[model samples]
Target: MFKFGNIYIIAAVAVIGGALFGFDISSMSAIISTQAYLCQFNQGGLDSDGKCVGPTPDVQGGVVAAMPGGSWLGALVSGFASDRFGRKTSIQIGAVIWVIGSVIVCASVNIPMLAVGRIINGFSVGICSAQVPVYITEIAPPTKRGRLVGFQQWAITWGILIMFFICYGCSYIDGTAAFRVPWGVQAVPAILLFCGLCVLPESPRWLAKKDRWEEAREVLALVHSHGNADSAWVRREMEEIREMVEFERQNADVTYFELFKPKMINRTMIGVFTQIWSQLTGMNVMMYYITYVFTMAGLASDDGTGVLLPSGIQFVINVVMTVPALLWMDRWGRRPTLLIGAFFMCLWLCVNAGLFATYGKPATGNHNAAVSMSITGAPAKAVIASTYLFVASFAPTWGPVSWAYPPELYPLRVRGKAVALATSSNWAFNFALAYFVPPAFANIQWRTYVIFAVFCAAMFIHVFFMFPETANKPLEEVEQIFDDTKPGAIKYIGTPAWKTRNTRAAVLKQERDQLASDEKIDAAAHKESVNA
Candidate 1:
């Protein structure tokens, strides 16, 4: 009897690290716009109109960009850590880092302190972001891998949403408590993650790679087969894992430089660029500086609570829409969903650029009542709606797919290194955008959306030509798609070998039967040789 319950528990507990990732996103986004944070860190002071004036574009960009700078370092280090320490231990280390970072952020009294804390937080996020999907993919059944790995993205969105509300509630406070309360609360999830990881089993594939065959067999049996070590399903799966690991050990030494080898470069590029494209989608700009977007869209610049409404809406939409995407991902396939999402995101961004160009006003240095009330009508609402539409388009597609895709792209030998490289690309671009958006908004205004719109269009063409479908394919089989050199391979990029559940079941049955036959033949040959 197969038991899914243990796998679900493991995934659920493991992905709490994602909540910390989310909390940092909304927590900083919320604070940067608050009067208390502005007053403390940005040299903000009361103007003639008695309203707070926040940090200049460069300062704000540096503060926001600092996290990903640390994240880039963290992502690079995580590959080595996960490979050496194991996945569960790597995640636990990240959780400890997160709690410490959160505490630092919550206690900060100045800009440097806050930046340091955020960088620490970013480092932890980088580790978790790289490891969580790989761990989940390694542990999950092939049929449920996409959905299970998807839980990381789901938790991230939930963390962002929950923190948005927490910050909203804090905005009512009079002083630094507005930011401190929310920052401190993030430690809760980090603590949960640290505690939970204490009991979770290490990834069986990782254990097998380390030549711990007995432990890997026991873990596979525990997770996949209700503790039945003799179950055919467990036996066949372990045999497949052992064969792959042995072949890798004999054929290649896992190294970062190996990822650039000719045979591996295509998969490496796919992983790296997929992550780069994900950051360029302008989603984080919306996430990190939503208040600024609302202000430009004609919402009252002074109305902190009102600005939060869109963040709230974005959170709700992200949570709601991601479910359908998860359900449809394995069924409809990865390539089509990504292609469709890029197209729609391009459409919405174009609309946003047009609306902002038509009705946009420059952001004043200080919030003014008159400026706030200047343009309140259809144009503002259109910009707001278009922003929501863009989020709606992304939540189901790029948001989740970014986290899910890279882990499945590489073989076990280089999976950690490949994912780290890809994830580092994500953070590198993430730093670029986080640094660019504030100044871009200040200078070009509406043209900012135009830049993202163009990127979205380019991404569609890239996905169509380069990305192959990995949905519903077993880890070993996914490599074959890239290895294929047939003339019409591009045309079949989005097609899966086993298209339905029944077909997949039939294929697994055949493999199991073949394995049993091979075992019998080997046993007979060994017996005859010994007798002779």
Candidate 2:
């Protein structure tokens, strides 16, 4: 068996790019409330209470939305990069892009420059988002794949957590230094990721797909079998991979258009909608506009500490909750985990909406006064508690599952393109939500939770009906689940793959034993006949 440590190391290094993704998410939100950031970029000056009156709703939306727009372009192009240059190389390229973007953002003097920098960073994040999971899935052993791939999500949360605290610390600084310090810190992860990738092995599956069998075998031996090139387990796994690759090469002309075929369309939609639903869950709303939520909840609207405290709590909850998810995701299956998470998310959203509706007052056109009085005491505390619960529910479910599911659905032929499309769908919807939230809060106030609550309800239905159980299945076997004409296909799709895999493994062992017995008997007979 592979050394588990090596597997984690590889996965960890590859997923550092996810840190950059998380950093960007929190970095903007963190600084938006700072007087320096607002005075530099926004039109209106500081209010009577000294809170910086910032960009208009439309401008704010565009600035916040720009990264996802860039991410969309980055994700679309990443498919080609992954297919052409290889997954490792694509990730390295993304790291370089991220550093470039980080510099621009750190040095930005105007809103346009900041937007450009965010777009660049967004592009880089898109590349990482699409390729990292695919690379992890291809390299990880079947039993450990879910948790291994889930590392990206874990890194993402860690990134958010670190950036949140960094921004909090930076809040003490006056002038442009407040924002610049946090913005500049992003380069560290990007650099480390690039260096890490330089020393790592290329994905064995990608090597094998290109007919580089010897190289692929070497990688699999080193990575999966602890340098035992002749180990039966490694041989068996390599053989299966080779056969699958050869079969696809001979039978199918793989292309982007192949994803649209009847056999593949359902799987494609499953990938796309998984991401769409993830963005609609209002997780980013919390990640991006949490200060606003806290403000409305009766926390100090003007103090950075008010935003920092709840976000720090969120970061802790996100990290803690994900551990159980990684532990249980393979056991519980993707659909059930996602379904349960969505149900709770809906419930929490409804509770949040109700709390806000009951206790929250309408904005009086004075930003500071409106938030300062709208919430307080027991009702305010309940709103904060519900927000945490919502995050807790999502951390274990949609947060990681969205990243894990898409790569598992498509065959090798179109896997890169399919994931790219799915990731783009994520960014597209993310753009809509990120752009919409500021205005949404501006216009609808507490009612915004109601919209997300409805979306959560819809997502629950979608997962129950459309998503099949993929946990513990080999990538090849997962492909078979889509074949309608295959006998017992319905049962295969509906049931957890782990159970079926166990049964199949047992049957195969019995067959092997029986064949060995027959061979021994035949050898004994031959010896007797020769002696006679």
Candidate 3:
């Protein structure tokens, strides 16, 4: 009944979905090295000397990879859920699933049970991750769209930071409780998100497609005009949405096959690859496996404090750096932001690779085989700083842009499904990398950074050649940029049309003014007819 009308409040509330993802990230990252976790889950348990060597590299990788594997399936289904149930309802469903998954995760007694619980939790994340951006983008005004959708990424960082510290604090508690407490605590945010969704409005575009025209107009007015349905801005937006929805209705028997058609394939490719590239940036390596990286850099200690504190600092940097991107995303535009981010990320990864290769040596210390090589002193410090810089590069750029971009590339008829497909690509790659990185560390050592650096380089080239500018354009206009038939369209680069700021607002204002002129002419004609 008390729906949030302010765009910022809506964004803040909806992005709790993203925070669920954040909670999962740190829940394991914070506790995997602890004695309780090692004893409870690792196959070998403690070594002959009673050192807390956790699971073998492959086993650990499987445990970490489980969530994303489940997420891949959940993402594939989210499109149907959102399209049929509505975005608000779909996110609510995800919240409920997260609570169930968290409970299972908290109650697990062994590795198989743990993996199963994480898989369930990952399913919820897949749904939330795919739909939160779509809901935010639909409600936000064009000029502020990027900033608002960017909130999802910001929420994710906060979730990571808050949960990491919670786990850090709990680490001091005696066995079992250290990890169980944080895993169980993850359910709290899901509860909040479920309750929050009760008061959130469904996407106005979704309302329009359902032929609930008056409801759509009211929602638009509520979001953009303080409940004034007669406002010109609201009217123009509703008109654009109605026209687009009407046109799409002609071919609205939407299927995944539709996305591969010539008119839509470019966006589908861009959307899917954009998500893939985001994971390949290796930011998640720093988030999920940073402790491992730090250990390899000779930062591990018996109590785990050495790596935990620095990992905490990286999460802080991630949260702080995202703020500016949310503020300036529209001004900077998507293509330039991604290109610049990829370039800097590549640079940082290269520095990390060179440092590790140059100064690292085979480990003989009390470390897991996963950390086969160790670097100390100056080179190790450089490795840590390089990781920080890599995160800084990704936080404001690929992190937010990747989530916001895909949902904006589709029509109302297929947005939920298209974004689901794209997000599944993200999860697929996420599963592979999460599973691969631990073993990679064991086998290749310094070459892990080299692989990611190469990915960042390829991503820079891809963004430059394939991604067109989408910033400040209405969702309806984005498809035209990919349409070769459109007289002045551009896909590989920006067109002259998108050069100006607030382009959507400007276009809407012109249309509003023209509507007034036409209405006045028709009124005058009707008056002359009555007189005659």
Candidate 4:
């Protein structure tokens, strides 16, 4: 069978899993405001102004939240599936599951049925989100790992952009077809992902865990050395992997409980909180309900294009800004990227909140009361621009780093389980916010942005003091850094090496020189033996 050996090809195909997540996101976001969707699922139906009035916020929230609720469970189960079935097979399973879910969603006749279908789709997303990063991280060279794993986030944004446009185009169609067409179309990516997995190699680290040494070496060479199994880089990587795998095998009985133990708790906290913080950045509120946000900002109207076109611009900005992270994440490193991202997101959110609070007024009859307050004129434009700024900050920073950082934190023994746990934290928070935000908009009004701003501020502080820089370090070395560094309960106590590490160029040069010294030593020893 023809197998894909190019790391770029593997990343592109595997990140279709991430695209599936993106598809699900825009699948609803694009259509939620359309008349057909409002007519089909909303009980109160369209108001005098043709906006969805609905039977309370929970119904809409539940419909949107179902996928993430299912995703939370799917992420938990993914660890077992990836560990037992291999990373390639786990993603294939998710793809198959997504097709089934999309079909149910497309065929749904009512809200209950729609929710069930979305839940199923969420399950698939949960699995793919947890494992795609794991697979990519395992195959990528240390120097390029950030860029490759970053493809997952990039794929997600592309999925969002593509699906949003697809649904946006379909929104012009009459009746329920507006939603059904796009919902059904979501199955296409999953089908492509399932077929793509046929030619993709399993994670080499997974192969090593199964005691398939030769297969592991072949995969490593395929990815890193253009299929030269005997290449020095390949040999060095395989040896390191073998050592770690064997070391982990000694305690192979490790389970979820082990993640909570003193030795592992710090990493577990970092991984879990990283995911939670990403969701709390309030970006999802923008993605899931941008139309509602724009309505509140007084930029939207009955025609929907006012909201759709601007929201489309936001999605475009999200996709375009992410390219920088893929290019420079390894060089710029994780710590600074996160800190800067968080601070700016917080600033933008604050700006958005102040604009809304200062210039907004109570929403009047037939003018989308769900948004509660409306801001017009200059303040409203500032609100919209601040949202774009917030997304730009998130796209290159927390967006990719959250996914890339967690998988690098664990040892081979429990990597799958640990990553699953971290991703589950993401879904759990996602489910809550998806359900909570609509009602929050109606009740708390501008204060919603205030809450997200606070989350961004707290996360900035946390990253500054807690997150270790993992850029350019081998996965094995990342574990050692965590062990070697001490965590303190207060500020200015036990600052981490991430604050002091040399530049990426210096680090790579040091490793290359060490490898040369080792090779020369081995050559001299062999020559002495031959002479004797």
Give the candidate order by descending TM-score: 4, 3, 2, 1
Per-prediction TM-score to the true structure, in the order listed:
0.90, 0.90, 0.93, 0.94
Tell me the tens digit of each residue's lDDT in model 1 across 268-373.
8889998999999998878898877776565544535667766688778878888887776666567777888999999999998887776766555565221222
lDDT for every model? Answer: 0.81, 0.82, 0.86, 0.87
Q: Write down the lDDT that model 3 would get.
A: 0.86
Error of 1 at 354 (Å): 0.3
Candidate 4 lDDT by residue in tens digits, 1-532: 7789999999999999999989988877777776677767668756766566544566888888999999999999999999999999999999999999999999999988999999999999999999999999988888889999999999999999999999888878888888899999999999999999999998999999999999999998788767878666677888899899888877748688989876788889899999999999988767998988887777765655567878889999999999999999999888889989999999999998898888999888753445688888888899899999999999999999999999988888889999999999999999999999888988999999999999999998888778887788888877766552344432222346347452589768977896687567667867888999
Model 3, C-alpha of 443: deviation from truth (Å): 0.5
Please give the distance, in angstroms, between residue 283's alpha carbon in candidate 2 and its true position after superposition.
Answer: 0.4
Rank order by lDDT, top first? Answer: 4, 3, 2, 1
TM value for model 3: 0.93
Question: Per-residue lDDT of 59-111 in model 2, one digit per residue for the tens?
Answer: 77788888988898899899999988888999999999999999999999998
Candidate 1 matches the true fold with a TM-score of: 0.90
TM-score of 4: 0.94
The parts of candidate 2 lying over 4 Å away from their true place are 1-5, 251-253, 301-303, 368-373, 484-532
Most accurate candidate by TM-score: 4
